[model samples]
Target: MEGSAVRHFTPFWFSVEPVDTLAVRGAPALLNCSAHSDTPARVDWKKDGTFLNLASDDRRQLLPDGSLLITSVVHSKHNKPDEGVYQCEASIESLGTISSRTARLTVADGDGGSPGGWLRAVPLAIGRAPALHLCTPASVEGSHAVERWLFSH
Candidate 1:
């Protein structure tokens, strides 16, 4: 049996590069920050200027490859606040620290389709001739009341 020799690490340094990613409203997004080094380094991600707190938010998760994964993206002021500059940093005990370029996270604005929003739901019709139903109260007393449908071209 042959014995394997343990490899030692040197002062090798690599750049941390994070690419800008686009995400649609109400969808998932992933921001990747990958790097390489002779010695393993600690990776940390920051948003806008503050360090990300992965423990507080359940929708945010830190992947094993030093990437940030967003569960759902909501383009609203009170909802998800994920639109901002993102940066990745890598540091080693023996080696030096390196930070990646600032990547902007843009969340696409979605058309507001709330119940009382401006965009109302369209009535769906299957055939050419549509049917219209008018409901009236039965407790009406009238001598000669006639209802007629008027059509205008």
Candidate 2:
């Protein structure tokens, strides 16, 4: 994309799919974000409009491929300033900044010990629908191409 340079320039950005939202409390989660481009830029992890400290002693880590890992995350932590919305903003030099679809992290009822906890989730279900990813994750993540099956319904 080429154009005249005005006072400021905004780059053509990328897009994230309709996110598969999760509702859980006191459990670790990883928000998977995969990019189609390799342009070096900054990716921000934000919770409730503020910068999330990914380097804290908490197991939360910012994966290099653009995913967020929330270790031992509690639902109580998400209900206030941290409990609202989480967004992944990617900024590229030529492409400016774009964000992932905001994920509404909610508190789930009951403990996460249900036998169905490991069942097919609402968004991705192998039994209900044959799953096919339009774009697959890169070859970096160890289990990128592997798909597991569960027959006990």
Q: State each candidate's clash count.
A: 0, 2
Judge candidate 2 at residue 67 and give its lDDT: 74
lDDT of 2 by residue, 1-153 (tens): 469655554333444422444534445555656555556657777777777887664657887767776655554533432245788888776666777777765444324343333322223554322232222223345656543443322
Among residues 3 or more apart in sequence or in different chains, the pairs in candidate 1 whose N, CA or C atoms overlap within 3 Å are none
Candidate 1 per-residue lDDT, tens place, 65-131, comes to 7778787766686765888899888788766778888888776544533222222111224321112
Which candidate leads in lDDT? 1
Residue pairs in candidate 2 whose N, alpha carbon or C atoms collide under 3 angstroms: 78-83, 79-83
User: How much lDDT does candidate 1 score?
Assistant: 0.62
Q: Which ten residues in a row have the lowest lDDT in candidate 1?
A: 114-123
